[model samples]
Target chain A: MRAKTADKIATSIIIAVAALIVLVLAGLLGYILYRGLGHISFHFLTSAPETIRKGGGIGPQLFNSVFLLVLTMLITVPIGLGAGIYMSEYAPANRITNFIRLIVEVLSSVPSIIVGLFGLLVLVNLFGFGFSLFSGALALTVFNLPLMVRITEQGLKGVPREQKEASLALGLSKWKTITSVMLPISLPVVLTGTILAAGRVFGEAAALLFTAGMSSPRLDFTDWNPFSPFSPLNPFRPAETLAVHIWKINSEGLAPDAAEIAAGASAVLVITVLLFNFGARWLGRYMYRKFTAIK
Target chain B: MNSIIEINDLDLFYGDFHALKHVNMEIPEKAITAFIGPSGCGKSTLLRTFNRMNDMIAGTRIEGSVEIAGTDIYSDEVDVETLRKRVGMVFQQPNPFPKSIYDNIAYGPRLHGITDRKKLDEIVETSLRSAALWNEVKDHLKRSAFSISGGQQQRLCIARALAVEPDILLMDEATSALDPISTLKIEELAQELKDRYTIVMVTHNMHQAARVSQQTVFFLNGEVVEYSETERLFSNPTDQRTEDYISGRFG
Candidate 1:
């Protein structure tokens, strides 16, 4: 009887804690939506900023955020994935590998503001890229690479040893086994990591501030040329992403409706990050099912 | 019968631990040879040496020679990939590759560069049939390998090993984790497979050795306690250790 009573009390306390977390998340989301939804309008979403007017959209900033994300992912995926495979499958587990791992862990734990400083020094100033999308993407890559490598390594290591043994026993070479068997098995987890990294890239303001700069050129939507300064395809142009724009509007925005714009931008940023987290889980499940045929 | 695998003064060590000590044995071709011993007696270790599967383990060292069909497998000229191709192995657990049934069987053939769809289909069929799982799984070839029962999964593993067209099939306690019915099915499958491929199995069940294998090797403390014709060894003992073990006197 005493044991059952203790169990009941423990269960209630756990439930109360879980409920508290849910309530906090719900309250925060509700509060943001309530304040921001009123300011979100068709004109506010599509038109460029007008310093003299009350209604100005974050059109260029949105495009810049999406473009920056694409460029960063393009650079980070191949290098991070290859490094992960080498670390997990080929490298001998000696002091050298351990030391490298320790370095990666330390790098991952470094504050984003420090990474922004690094980008400002090496990519923006030293390399003379001069506040452009390319510099920003490179900065984000350095910030996210350690995370990708760590996640991919864990995903690869999570695979059962029997799978590798079975593949090798069938006379497949080690590389072949890794490519055909191991990679496919670890695909879902790797993809989840990629999405999570993307979410981080989407919202990162500190790193982009120093590397991408706080201004955007007037883009010619019709210009498809990669070399044009105003073309969205040009990586050399200065891009002000959504998070950075929000930061700019909050601190030094000169427009009459700066507070409203900041609220709307914050809402959009939060929504995008939420979508990424949810999409990561959904896609991970879908891939696992497709590959393993589990219901 | 001619000998297919010859182990001469073979010794195996895992770091400071001596696993198999100066073992010598000859396994006949197209016959079922069984290795039986108590836990950690190195029966499985000897089995792994046939394909050099122990090479994956850190601090593992092999001394002397293990030759298959007169070719020394450990020689510098030998490619480990080609050697493994000729000698396939099945593990204690059912380890399907979390792929479609067709893909699981086709995985081995695909690795060796067999890309023709019809050829892969045909190989999948024959391998599944040889493992005696064709009738049960024929309709679900496109389904996931994990969708099947444990017994079916083990049989799928057997079919996978067979898909490589190996000269020898090594079973390391293949049915030790199965139900009685599954165990019976695998034991029967092993008997049938021996007619085509040289089958070597390590088992803890003495009765399984008696029922399935033509030759039986008993191991204890990293040494061969007794090895002879299965019938002779079981019915009339040459070694007292073999007699004691068969009669269920301490392993």
Candidate 2:
């Protein structure tokens, strides 16, 4: 075959593959919205589910998902950033460092269901935390921490070597050079990765099933005190996130409109994750501009 | 003129590779010294040793002593940070922080705890003027360092190095990446800077060494083959290798 003809064939195949991916994504999104959008309303979004009734809502589950995400991030960000900085900047390349990297890679690839089982065994039973939001957040941390560390490490490594050299040659302390020069340049990548991880936390179900539990206590939204048992802010209370609620409703929900509730909840979950992905891109670009002064 | 930097039997190794062998020289204060040699011949490596920048490289070892202002810089008592503060370096590529023009100049000062706004402003102005960049960038002090042209960015880097008021300034092929006009501008700036700061430069261009430097050192295979006044070395080279190199016989 002629080289030009072969090149044309290769280009078409590549475009067809890319188009197939976009088509699949669009079809999935269209089907979910078509089945779920009609059922969505302010009442459906803000009211509690009816266990045996024809009408049900996912208000508390939605709030639980958001709250659990915030809690997990509060625990994960500091630990992840610290570990990442050490791995990228401070840690010498040795057997120990390589072992730590191997552990992180292994941890990230662990099945979410396995993580849930482990959470049930350790956090719920051994630690005596019970099936609470705190336990779920901890479980999610195990799932998300590896990702955050890898992202931060890669981001820091992406910074130009000359930037670090320039800062050091100016007599800046090692710590100052990292915090002032390196971190700022890598912030966009780190921020985007953090939000992408947050999206994972939002849509995660299996990990939360055995840790956060499949039921929420009657929540008092007006009770802003974190220590109160009934307050939504309480991390110790049993909570069901949107993804878990969708799973439970689809499996054995007693409600007559269980399928509709599941569909609607799934749609909401998808929308939230999509929003997070877009937000990460936009925020990353915005930060890069703010930090670097590039238009 | 009094010598400010003295090297006594200095040798450097990058793992198994001997980079600099038995180097000895006394560099005068407030003058320009240029190291001209072929690539990988240790001109840049010797420049890095002045501020211990080579310490960042893995498996890099050194012997003998390098003294600045009569103190052995390799001694345990000499803080690397303080040593670096006294000796500033500009690299081949212009590497201004991804920040405003003003911030790039003020970065060194801020690191050493200079936070007063007015004082930082004065340092910014004077440093820029010293680098001959003040008039061009005065109206755009808040602009990003990358917003300017490449030549301006190189000048901005020079300004950044000058902001800390170092006694010794090292330029490692500082204009190699620049256009001819920018290169000429930097050469002029180096000539002016040597009146106050001890200047050392490594250059691939031999004419650059002859044009700007007072003392010229020629290296071959990690050893200095010639060290003398630039005029004498170029016009009346004593060594056969130096004569061949200067007359464009070979690297």
Candidate 3:
């Protein structure tokens, strides 16, 4: 009788703990949607409200946010995945790999403000790019690189040793084994890492603040030209992403309609992050099923 | 059978630990040779040494010459890729790649620059036929290699190795992970394959050693205890250690 009573109490405690977790998640999701859903609109998504302008759309901000996310993916994907390959496949479990891993962990733990400060000194003042999309993308690259590298390394390491040996045993070279066998096998996880990094790029505000600057929205196509080298990509120009725009509206207070604008921008940001996280997860699952079915 | 591979005073070490010591052995051409011993007796290490697969391991050192077809394969002049092409390997588990059955077999030929679809198809068919797996997998070559059972996957791996037309095949306990019926099928395939290619296999099963191989090498504590005909080794081994190993005493 005593043992059964104790078992019942234990089961109730476990159930309560699980319910607590559900309640907490519901609370977080509810708060964000409740505060944000009311502000979303077409004008809020598209128009870029210029200095002291009341109820103008955030067109430039939306464009800049998308641009930064894409550029960061370009710069970081290769470097991150390459680093991961080196760490997981080529690297030995010795002092060198351990040291590199420690450094990466430390980098991930560093505050976003510090990453912003580093970008300001090294990228803006020292490098003569005051503030622009390029600088912001580079800063975000540094922030997201560690994340992708770690995740990809873990995924690659998780691959069966037998698969690698099988490839090599069949006279495939080291690079071929990596590209043809290991990389493809672990690609879903690598994509997840990249998507996570993109989410950070979209949501980040502190790091892009000083590096990307707040010089009011501009849609100049002259500097945006990609094929020419005669015109330098002028980083002195200010760029506004959605997250930065929200922060700007809250601080400046010149626009009395800033509250709705902030809520709407937050909604867009949340939706993007949700889509990225779920999209990457879905893609990973699809690839796994599709590939595993044939083998 | 004539000798195709010669190992003279070959020694292997993993850091300070001596793995294979003073291994002098000759593997005959186009014959199935079985290496029988308990685990960690350096059979697999010696096998890996043939193609320098142990080069991937850190602090793994090899001493002495492994001459294949009158060439010291371990020489600095030897390209690892070319050496691996001539000598392919299979593992204990059926590690069919996460690719289609046809693609897995064609990976090696493709690496060597055979890109024509008709030629690739020819190679895949011939390889699968040689492995005795063509009939089973002919209609489903487009299917994933991982979709097959353990036994079938092992056969696919064999076909994959054979696609390159390697002169030698190194199998490290290739049938240990299969069912009894699967093990018999692989044994029969190995015997069939021995007519055209040199086969070096490591096995823990005593009956498998006797049944599949014509030549047998018994190893104990990194040393070649005895080497003789399979019948002689199983029924009339001279060395006490060889007798012990064959009779299920101590390896």
Compute DockQ for each candidate against the true complex. Answer: 0.77, 0.77, 0.60
Better of 1 and 3 by TM-score: 1
lDDT preference between candidates 1 and 2, better one:
2
| Model 2 pairs in collision | none
| Residue B220, candidate 3: alpha-carbon lDDT | 88
lDDT (tens digit, per residue) of candidate 2 on A1-295: 6999999999999999999999999999999988988888888898999899988899999999989999999999999999999999999999999999999999999999999999999999999999999999999999899999999999899989999999999888889999989988999889977997899899899999999999999998899899999999999999999999999999999998898988888888888888878977888888777777767
Residues B83-120, model 1: lDDT tens digits? 88899898999999988999999989988999999999
DockQ of 1: 0.77
lDDT at position A88, candidate 1: 96
Candidate 2 TM-score, true structure as reference: 0.98
For all candidates in order, the CA lDDT equals 0.91, 0.94, 0.85
List model 1 lDDT by residue over A141-228, tens digit each: 9879998998889889988999999999988988999888888899888988899789888999999999999999998888989899
Model 3 DockQ vs. reference: 0.60
Fnat of model 1, as a fraction: 0.80
User: What lDDT would candidate 2 get against the real structure?
Assistant: 0.94
